[model samples]
Target chain A: MAIFSLWVINKAGGLVYQRNFADGLAQLTSNEHLVLAGTLHGIHAITSRLSPIGASSGAQVIEGESFKMTIFLTATGTKFVLFTSLHETTTDSVLQRVYEAYADAVMKNPFHTPEMPIRSEGFDSRITALIGTGQS
Target chain B: MTIYSLYIFDRHCTCVYYQDWHRTKRPKPAVEGGILPAVSHAITPQPLPADSNAGSTFTSPRNTLTSTSGVVIAVNEPISPGPGLYQTPPSHQQTQANPPPSTSGLAFDEEAKLVYGVILSLRNMIKRISGRDEQFTNYRTSTYKLHLYETLSGYKFVMLSDPNTDSLRFVLRQIYNGPFLDFVVRNPLVIMDSKERGIDNEYFRANTDRLVKGLSVFP
Candidate 1:
């Protein structure tokens, strides 16, 4: 089980935070990450509206043969997105841990601004530590 | 605990078949046929006497849905008195060729086009992220999940069901292999991707309904 990458999108649909691991997958440029993140944001909103049921949530999982992307949307509209291997059994636990870390390291940080690119060193180390332990 | 609908898109990206069991507000008819949209309004006043046991207000509109859908449901009524497997006369099947009539009022051609667009963009995204060997199976919303099964022949079978249910891709595959192959693909009488017609027939609809009803999660 391995996590390939992580993306944090602000409520405004901007790519605020992005990171990559698992070197085997093809890498993307910063521009590509912004484009992909924006596209995903748009698609997520469209999917939520596509359903005939009440529109509380949108797409949660997009699975491929080798990897799967799990998206968690917070009540405030911020999205925590993760791309992991298909065999990753601890995704939910890992995501819960990451959310807890975000609440601590990012949200509580005085230097961190809302809806902007995340650049705090403490949050970076915390995410790295989370991903390190997340690998099984 | 409900299966909403199923749509089959042929190679040309045209919705060739559609069926829905529990859907509430009907989809507005596409602007393609100004007359058909008018017909939908005219038919809305009368309600179909359907079993309300599902605790859904959706079943009330089943009878006056559309001519093609109305016939398909009526053919399956207990009044027909046919065995589990029996022949339905060719006349009982919807055979309109020109104008490519939409079957059910629950979802129209316009909605099907949006369905195709969703999957198409999702599939394209999957391709961009992973190799060609990988494909997307399903995506979920708060209320429902959409399962997709793509055939080598370019047929796409999409089913929407309760979000709590497990993967329904296997069920979609079975439909493609069973009823779809038997009634549509294998039969020479039906054109595969004709723009002027849909591939829906009584045999396929009955078998699909039976298959969905047989599912453990169906409610």
Candidate 2:
């Protein structure tokens, strides 16, 4: 039931926003973060391309020792990645809430410059609150 | 439903446009002068490592070579000279012109700079963290909300409203897709990089004003 972090990646494979909630993960340098995002994007693309049935959407989950990652891609190509405990099964609802928050706070904001990193306090607070409530 | 102001900054971190409305107290005149410089300083991009692969993907084709170097020289002078449209009077001048009213205005300027700096740093940090291109939408404080809408070419539209104000990102996008693209970005008469520091087209202003005012919650 513990959520570690959330990340939003744009169509071009650039990370737009990321927030950490639980604190056990090792910290990464900025360049490492970029590399990680690019790698994930590449892997996602490759996974879709190599799908046995044909080019499907993308990878949905990556289970690790410490946490499990769930990825959801929007029709518009935006990707939402959530890292949570292995026991958490409600990742879909979390992603849905995150998408709604993105649309309401980020998409609806007039000052959000396109293709830049997200810095919306409203979005941050909303997501944090969501995770907090979910954990409790 | 008080809308304090709006500011538009280019990717280069230049405060190209600003306007304030329905505020009882305004920042001091000196405070206004520091905004652009502070924003520019706050937005100064960190030099990327030579081996950085992220740099290649992060760079946009629309950004000119000079902009990448981060030393922006105004290529064209702002077309309009009318101070009426550009200048905002100092709030303290209405009360006392002598010893400079208390530090509230200066404090406000610092707060504004802090907010802008937070936005810029958060943007950069997100890029590093996510390893993908992303855009910020809006931020809300206890007392105020800051909404941002950015174009692909890196033009930023910003608005500050009361905390309870509904979404204004659509309005910003409309302004961008409509009057901004049609009149300023597309129109040859308007120079985005000029010292004039605003979209001087009357048609753009008029239409944008109409759009902003048309918002249901706007005071």
Candidate 3:
């Protein structure tokens, strides 16, 4: 599982965080990022409301032939996204581990604000360590 | 016959007048021309019925003067300033826009400070409602670089970054307009007014664009 980027959107659809990993995406302006955050937040909210209870939240964990966008929940009701793109691999364990890492590194960080951008150095170091160790 | 009337003019310049005509007559005819006394007296100031005051209290603070035909004037005198519950800081050209050497020389450090200040301010705003501080520890080490620029109209924009994250720098601009500007500036409780203290808006707006462009993800 390779996490390509992350984004945080407030309840009001404002983008609080946006990041890209593994590098294939085009660059976007800060304003564009904000707009994307807002739009994604809106879509997530609508998806949640339309979800059938006792089922997973409408956030999709798609494992296409080439890429995936996994949306999961943070403790403060914000979303954590980890995107991965690969030609061939089993993504189940990668996605789950990524979620766990996020819970530990980002959500549990006392310095992290809900619905705000993730900025903790510890979170970054831990993720790099995890991905680095696995790569070797 | 003479009549006094209340007339309403329409948008198309048509006038609709409501009138009660009167004729001077013998005292015996007083009962027959009963409308004059009642109408004239009603036209003069009299205590209105209790229900009249119930609807609304929007008083027009202007005196209406009737001049020649098709002419009307509403003169609204300027209101005197209220007592000094709040004092306004004198207006001046902002120095932060062109900050002195002490400020501009440390532009890099200033950008970092802006990020920290903004984050702390945001956290405080949220904490006012959330009442929790658990997230503070994780957010502390995040590093940011900022750049600022001023538009020709004197508005400022700021670009902000957190280097460890893959996200690009974000930009913020002043979206507030007139009355809201007054609310923040004229408010006595605001310790740093935009015009006087020059810290809040000038710093943030001026460097937004530069900050956004300067963002670089660190290894």
Say what the interface RMSD of candidate 1 is: 10.4
| lDDT tens per residue, model 2, B47-140 | 3431232211121111121222222234232222122223323442222212221222222333344345445654554444434464445444
User: If both were scored by TM-score, which would come out higher, candidate 2 or candidate 3?
Assistant: 2
lDDT of 3 by residue, B1-219 (tens): 111111111122111111112211101111111112211221222233422421121111111111211112232233232232112222211211222211111111121232233333333322321233311111111122222222334333332223234212122223223221444345554443123222223322334323333434321
Report how far residue A99 has shifted in candidate 2, in Å. 28
Q: Model 1: what TM-score?
A: 0.74
Question: Least accurate stretch of 10 residues (summed lDDT) in model 3 chain A?
Answer: A47-56
Off by over 4 Å in 2: A5-136, B30-102, B107-115, B195-197
Q: Between which residue pairs do clashes occur in model 1?
A: none
Worst 10 residues of 2 chain B by lDDT: B56-65
lDDT of 2 at B133: 62
> Residue B155 in candidate 1 has what lDDT?
87
Docking quality level of the chain pair in candidate 3: incorrect
* Overall lDDT per candidate, in order of appearance: 0.68, 0.58, 0.34
TM-score of 3: 0.32
DockQ of 3: 0.02
